[model samples]
Target chain A: MLQALRDTLPANRWIRLVLLAIVLGVIFTPWLFDGTRALDTAARLSIFVVLAASYDLLLGFTGVVSFAHALFFGIGAYAVAIAFDHFAPGFGVLLVAIVAGLGVSLLVAFIMGLVSLRVKTIFYAMITLAVASAATVLVSQLYHLTGGEDGLTYRIPKVLTPAFKLLDDKVFGVRVNGKLMNFYLVVFSSIVLFLIMVRIVASPFGRVLKALRENDFRAQAIGYNTLAYRTTATLLSAAFATLAGVLMALWLRYTGPESVLSLDIMIDVLLMVVIGGMGTLYGAIIGATVLMLAQSYLQGLMGNAQDVIGGVPILSELMAPDRWLLWLGLLFIASVYFFPQGVVGRFSGPAPKEATT
Target chain B: MTTRVEPIQATGGEPVKQHRAWWHRPDAQAAVLVPALALLALPLTGDFSAWLTLTLAGLAMGMMLFIMTSGFTLVFGLMDVLNFGHGAFISLGAFFGFTVLAGLESWRLVDSLWLNLLAFGLAAVAAMIACGLLSWAFERVLVRRVYGNHLMQILITMGGLIVAEQLIYVFWGGEDWPMLKPAAFQGGLQWGDLVFEKYRLLAVVLGLVLFAALMAVFKWTRLGLLIRAGVENREMVESFGYNVRRLFVLVFMAGSALAAMGGVMWGLYDEVITAHLGQSIMITVFIVAIIGGLGSIEGCFIAALMVGLLSNYVGFLAPKLALVSTIGLLVVVLMWRPQGLVPATQGGQ
Candidate 1:
């Protein structure tokens, strides 16, 4: 059955190879580079992978442009943090937190969708922007509950911290500690979440969603309740985004408005989706890796740029670490102009058909 | 054959009906609504003087917003382009206008009101010209590439905004500048228990003058006719031997200039300016634009007044929930109107 499953995989050999390499690389990252930093980066990549994929559910498959996605992500993070802070930090608490977070996300998604979906594309986008900004401000002002801009830090399950070592001795050239276990948990859940998303995208419901995105009027003409389909897609996407947010909180052991729900983060998600490729799920993975790595490494390079160049006046100013966003913005525009289909689209050649008019 | 015996009395009835319909016109009704709302609030606040002050302040705020948003609404109405980077022009205007004012410090520091006004006007014109030229290039290079695609237009323009913001940082450093009002407009006017800021009053007067000028140009100009015709049918206008594309570019430039003018006023109002002045204000600007309808200047103007008043009232009453109230207002407006308060198109958004 495993051999048959391998045989029936899509003929995209390069993509499969890339995926295999990534999974193996992440598994061995602790042994490969600096242990804690490598693990942390891998963990972050996994969280963003989930984020990018969930975003794709709306932007790529559903073709809905929403600016309030990070609101759900923030809610999930806050939920987990609040739960840990108020209740016991145990597995059961975590379970309840996940459910609660997802429930709230679903409810918010439904109401926002109902209100915003009535408008045309541009207006819908604007309304979401307004809602998102308001929610961000609310989160900050409700300092008692949300920790405001300073954010909230909490204890995870005892099993996930470095104090609780899994073994007294080293294993696989690395210490078997609670941190390692936690990293593994993050990677594992991310893989599972990714698979579930893949399954959903491959389903019949997903196909109908694609149809609606391509031409909603035509889909309506064909007797499909486009609104219902869109609302359901929105709910599902919000649920997954919240899960990603919860995972992020767990991995970081802290969550805050700036870290989890900033408009900057929303724009980063957009950059990831567009740079990767909109409709292709594999693009999400690739985009997340490229952006996260660039952000991490380029920031370091920028800080030390003056020392390396030694008084090249223009280069020194241009390479200031704080100026990363400028470069990212330029990269975003170039990608949209030169690669409307994104990197994945370019690599895969032309699409089977036009996904949007 | 019966048409030959039409009654002259029916002709008299037509004039009365037309006059009555004029009162029902959306703009006319909106004009009444603004004053009526102020009167209604007077009793609630129970301080006629304070209420009057707040209402005037709100109108001043609204007029400034209208100035900023008019160009955007007009450009979108005529061109169907969604320029998310419109806010960048606002920031540019504020910065350059400040530069001009600072350079003319000799005039700004004077006790003479006429000299101060001259300095202010020159600064405004300088900012407008700078933004107008930049907007021309923006449309030619960035906007031209993403025409007809709303999604791409939004993304690219957002990219443009970020880039512009970073460039501002590069040129002007990442520090907030504290702006000072000119010597002539520094003090307030007092009448018994009521006191009003001189600058706020000036802002109100300037905004009204600009509004009147725009109304006049639009009402009695050949260019206005072409623009209205172009918005209703771009292809038809083009077929009529007019260069509709040039008109679009002109409108975009005009919009950018107006945004800059609004920015200058806002900077003066806030008394502080930052590199992200545009980005921070964009949320409220977008809300106003949405509430005013996508492509209607008149609608945008009315919505701006309502939002400004709502924001001030809410801020006074519930400081913590100021933003919440504004967003709540947006949701309610969208739910009730859907097409906004005075949608440009009669049907089919």
Candidate 2:
């Protein structure tokens, strides 16, 4: 049966279609049963998918490993919180929050890009790290503006009408409310962003960016303004990240430093990219989905089986909490060691060998 | 290949004569006298008590800085691979040291000052060995594959750091472990009106000794000669059939050991060991290493001291300013001398 399916879906188009169907099926799985938890998991996974895709613009295509991409995401979330605090609530305010967040990220990215572009690889990572650290400290210290570690809490508008719809009270025997509405909102946003990314990657601009990555010096010699192009890409990446951050804030109905911008968030995004496959756009979505699902299932299983160990209850306690990050780390190492292509890349084979000619 | 300007020809032949000047020589009497006099007079001009405290604290912190950056510079200078996970090794050492000490306390072992010192010494050695072996394995298996690829090295080492940190959180619960300074070394030393912590003074003395020993080894040891040669021309060392891979491993291990030692000292000094220490301070160490030049020991030493002093002084003026001072220093250094304070004679690719 597997062989027949593979044979039937030999073409890339058919494969993509099938993958899309699987994703939609998973997204709409809540309809089948009381999978409220699964719906929440999907929403969280969607946020990560957007984040990982944003990172791919820099990490996969440009070959720059930024350690501070979360700064933009955090800024976006904070922007929405701050905007909601002052402005009247509406879709227009949400749009303004996103723009404001993107604006800040762009300004920061531009300065960082200009300064660190001269230093590639490790040096670039160091510079970006410094910026992120500085930003974190600055935010934490600015007690008045950032709520000083207490974080800001804002009342999200109950109606997200135009962009989303709250189905019937018991639509298909499932309660449709904030969580479900937020679920659709995130899924819709993720699909839209994914499509835009597909278009961007397929464009002539992406080809030039790929060339720049393969051999930057050669690209420059061939008359490409490497720095300008790279800077543009960085800005675009930061803008998308901020947008995802805004969505995250809306989904969670709260924004805090821990939730939005932290080293852990950066690590999660990096894991997603690596596990999914570097360079491939769809890898982001696949990586985020797989990782989140694994985490949720593993945690749930461990949590439920805590009493099964009987005599050594400490074992279960040790098994359940805080082991996820450790497992993720181990997975990252194993992935690098065994499956360097990442999950998606391993299955897909190498990206169509780029034509140097 | 395109025709490239040689600029400065590689120095190949005889060892250059060591220049000795009264004020210029690193070990000169004036070299010590000038800094000593400046430090002594610093209190008169500033808040005397605050300056004294800051100077002492700076000295203590400077030693840790020296240890951290020295490993970073040595590894980068010798291997041309930036071990981004160097901080993880430091964190591992601190956590391991704390665990051993805590275990000893629980077991009702000799709770004497001497025993504590012994425990610390044993922990340091164990951490060094463990970190060295782990670093060697990592370099051999993963780093070796990406010899010339800086981007891959950065990403891989980053992944390594995340793994190590997460493993640490798994093994040791996510609570801070308090460290006890030896009772004999806990009290402050009184000299005239100035009071200083004996432990901090001990740290400074130990750091100086280690620095001297490292310099002596670099000047006289055969392994050191190979390292210097490898730094200049890795290919040439390989061509000579000197087991270049072994040398790389040795350098990386030594670097890891140095960072671990620093971690032990930092834990003792701070009186607490947390997994986040490595991630929190790693950036500052990197800044110091870069500002000092990628692989220069003397440069790292000097840069660490300057940074320690600068950070303390700035923190005194405004605490928040301390956060950005090192980054500001890094930017200035990069803009002025992109290579660093004392760049390698042979330029980097």
Candidate 3:
């Protein structure tokens, strides 16, 4: 158990403590937080943590820049949603969707890696962008199946709904209701998935990935089949993203193109990974929490500012609730330019050596 | 017998003697796709006139796409920079033209060809200036720091694209605005049973003129020669005592202005300007650039036409699959010639 713990914990004590606090806070959200909105936010925070961390594996560790991560996420979401629509709302249907989503994501990621990974980095990025855009169009156009752009709303398993109860008595003054049960399902599973990701990153496979990320040609010179390693990383990242999508759809009981497949969500994911600090899973968790809070609260603040500055002409428009994304964009730019290492990297990495001038 | 198909001097510069062979050269062979697509689409339409109308419209659409993609491809070829934020300029141009034309509605409604032309021309000029200026800052501010790093360039530029797009949303409201056409160019001319929109006709003419002018710039002028040389090898061009960085900015601004012009044309054609117009058109622009072979202007033209014709034909036949058809064209072309229809000979091709 100690060896397993060592494999999953961050090397930095501060980072590890922060990760622990975030995870414990999420696990106990039902007892600590009240209201449906709070629960919903906690669930989404868990899902986005997985999403951003999986993206980090591909982007930070492997150094393969892909724009189709959300496409895979959408596939997982739509697979679950469509399955629920067609079949009875049961655990069996959920299982089938998970399997199908994973299979499809692996297949697509494998083919994409083989085709575009052989090319230069720019070519790969452009092709993934093209594919992602095409996927969005297809999703939007297929209204009949995907419920069009409006998306689909379906009931999940009866046990997962708020009506069902896992226990007759309250546990720690928190009712053992179906909603709480479902939230635990998402949060606990997310913890497991995240720790597995940590273990993988600390494994030998991850060492090869590090070599490739630092210098591709040098890694290849050491007799490592670099292409195979890159493709495996793509597959692993896609699988995790798909699971995150599954958890999200299962929790929300709805799925839509705008929610899962849009470029905006992809942008949000990028912001999380880059701002959180690439290559650090703990940083991803921190990034996701901060972003989710900002999203929940910043837009409301902007709305108030919009009213206060209503008479200020152009400035009023900048303060509108919808304009929060403008700030997000600027933040993304600032992070990329000023702190390429990200928030976690800023503090955790060693200080720059003082010049002996 | 030996074949003389190989480039005699592989000085890493382009424009080899192999440009003459139509049957042998892959890019030249790719050119046949335009006619081939038009002819194949002709019989499917079941009438010559319908096919002609569709083909003409496609050619015009192709021209605008070429104009938009020409700059992006050149930027990629010259700087080795994949500026993902290039779409923001297109959005900027459309909004700029909308603002300009919105102010000149009186001139647009006058019904005189000169006034209408003047109104539209002024809008184009204004839009180009706005887009050009923004592009200059875009290069100097956001793009300058991320040079030489492809991953950072992609991330930073994408950030720029998002910011630029959101800024447009801030300035323009969240709704789609319908663009009003000049009275003189509102309707098409009836040549027998077929009706050709005057605006689309102008698009074709403007596209041709731009192409000719760009070709001349590439072939004749000192600026053109320098740009071509820079695209082939930036370090070599810089080593030759020329200011390649300044030249890059000039070419970047010019290309951005051209994209903005395409946006203005697109706004006129589509007649509805949304904040997402740049994002939507970028899908096609990227595919065209990739299919044309990144960094090859002529290839961009051919691929744009092929994509334009195929999309129009597909839109007519299967409206739902219009975007898919362009993607399909890209897949097919990439499978056939992975480098693009006209792969640039140097600069990481």
- DockQ of all candidates, in order? 0.63, 0.42, 0.53
Whole-structure CA lDDT of model 3: 0.87
Give the Cα lDDT of each candidate. Answer: 0.83, 0.76, 0.87
Report how far off residue B40 is in candidate 2 (Å): 14
Best by lDDT: 3
Once model 3 is optimally superposed onto the true structure by TM-score, how far is the C-alpha of residue B136 displaced, in angstroms? 1.0
Instruction: Please provide, for model 2 over A153-190, each residue's C-alpha lDDT reduced to its tens digit, 9 standing for 90 to 100.
Output: 87777674223446655777766666666678888887
True contacts kept of each: 0.69, 0.56, 0.69
Query: Would you give the TM-score of chain B in model 1?
Result: 0.91
Query: Candidate 3, residues B1-349: lDDT per residue as tens digits?
Result: 7966664676777666433545666666877878999989977988888788888899999999999999999999888888887888898899999999999999999969999999999999999998999899999998887778888888888888888899998899888988888999988999888889898899999999999999898888999888888877788989999998898898889889988998998998999998888877887888999999888888998999998899899888888898888888888888988988888763222
| Cα lDDT of model 2 by residue, B253-284, tens digit | 88888888888889989989888889888988
**lDDT for residue A342 in candidate 2, whole number 0-100:** 67
Residue B185 of model 3 has an lDDT of 91
Candidate 3 Cα deviation (angstroms), residue B141: 0.8
TM-score of 1: 0.93
Error of 1 at A130 (Å): 0.4
